[model samples]
Target: MREEVNMPLNLEEKKELVKEVSDVLLNADTILTADYRGLTANQLTEFRKIARTPGIYIKIVKNNMLKMALKDSEYAVISDKISGPQILATASDNPGEFAKLVKKFIDNNENIELKSLAYKGKELDLSEIKKLATLPTYEEAISMLMSIMQAPVQKLMATMTAVPTKMVRTLDAVKGTKN
Candidate 1:
C-alpha cells in the first residue's frame, strides 16, 4: 500500500491566502474563533451552510496562516484564541445576528466549543459573547424605538377620545332609563 503525501502550501499560495483572509478581516465587525475538534465532516458542512449569509464568512485554515492574516489587523487581538483545529467566523455587519447564529450552533452541537470573540478591536469572553447574541437586530431595534416613541402619542389620543365616548354612553343610559 502506498501512502499519499501531503503537500504544503507554497509561498505564493500562502501570500494569497493571507491576503484573502486580511480582506475579509478588514470589513469584519465581529470575529469569532471556535474549537471544532470533535465535529464530524457533516456537522462542519451543516455549519458552513448555516453561515452562508451574505456578509458572514467561515473558514477552516491552519493556525499559522490565520495568524499571519490577523497580523496588523484590528482582529489581531484574537490571535491568542487561535489554536488546535479552530474555525474562523466573521461578519461584516449585524454582529449580533452572527453571534446569535454561532450561539445557536453551539447550543445544538455539543462538540463545538466557542473559544473567543473580538468586536471592534476588543476581546470578549464567552459570557460577553452570549450577551451579544441576545442583542436585537437593526430593524428590531428601530421598531422597538418607534414603539416607545409612539406610545405617549397613542395614549394621549386614546385619553382625548375617552371623554366623548363616556359622555355618549351616559346619554344612551339616561334615554333608556327615561323610556
Candidate 2:
C-alpha cells in the first residue's frame, strides 16, 4: 500500500521557500503578467514553445503564492498586478524581445490579456509596455547605432578619395594655362 501522506511544512520551511522564490523573482531582468483564462491547452503549449527561445521562462502560479513570495521583495513592484489566474514570463536576455513576442501573440490570439509588466523592478504602464514591445532590442539598437556611426566615416573616405583627382585636374589646367 502507498505510504501515508506527509504532513505539511512548518512555518519556518514555508518562509524559506517564499524567500528563495522572491529572491529569484527579484533578480529577474523582466517579468510579464497576463491572464491566460481563455487560452486553450494547445495555445499555451505553442506559447511555451515560443517562449523557450532566447532564455524565456513561463510559469503559472496562484496569486496568493506569488504575493506571499513577493512581499517585501524587490519584485513587489508588480505585486499589485498579480491576481486571478495570472501567468508570468521571465526573460533572461533582451527583455523587450519577450515583451514583443507576447504582444504579437496577443495580437494574433485574442484570448491572451496583458495585465502588467516590469523591467528591472520598475512597473511599466500599458502604453509604455506597448512601446517597449515595438522597440528594437538592446543588441539591435547597438548594432544600428554602430552602422550609423560607420556611415559618415565611409562617406568622408569617399569624398577624400575624390580630392586627389581634383588636385591633378587643377594642376593640369594650370600647366596648360602657363603654356
In model 2, where do residues sit more than 4 Å from their true spots? 1-23, 167-179
**lDDT (Cα) of model 1:** 0.88
Worst 10 residues of 2 by lDDT: 1-10
Q: Write the per-residue lDDT of candidate 2 for residues 10-111, one digit (tens) a residue.
A: 667666656656766866787778899989999998888876676677777567777887677666878888878987777777767877888878888899
RMSD of each: 3.7, 4.9
Distance from true location, Cα of 14 in model 1, Å? 1.7
CA lDDT, every prediction? 0.88, 0.78
Superposition error at 108 for model 2 (Å): 1.1
lDDT of 2: 0.78
Best by TM-score: 1
Please write out the lDDT profile of model 1 over residues 36-62, one tens digit for every residue: 999999999989985687789999888
Badly placed stretches (over 4 Å) of model 1 are 1-7
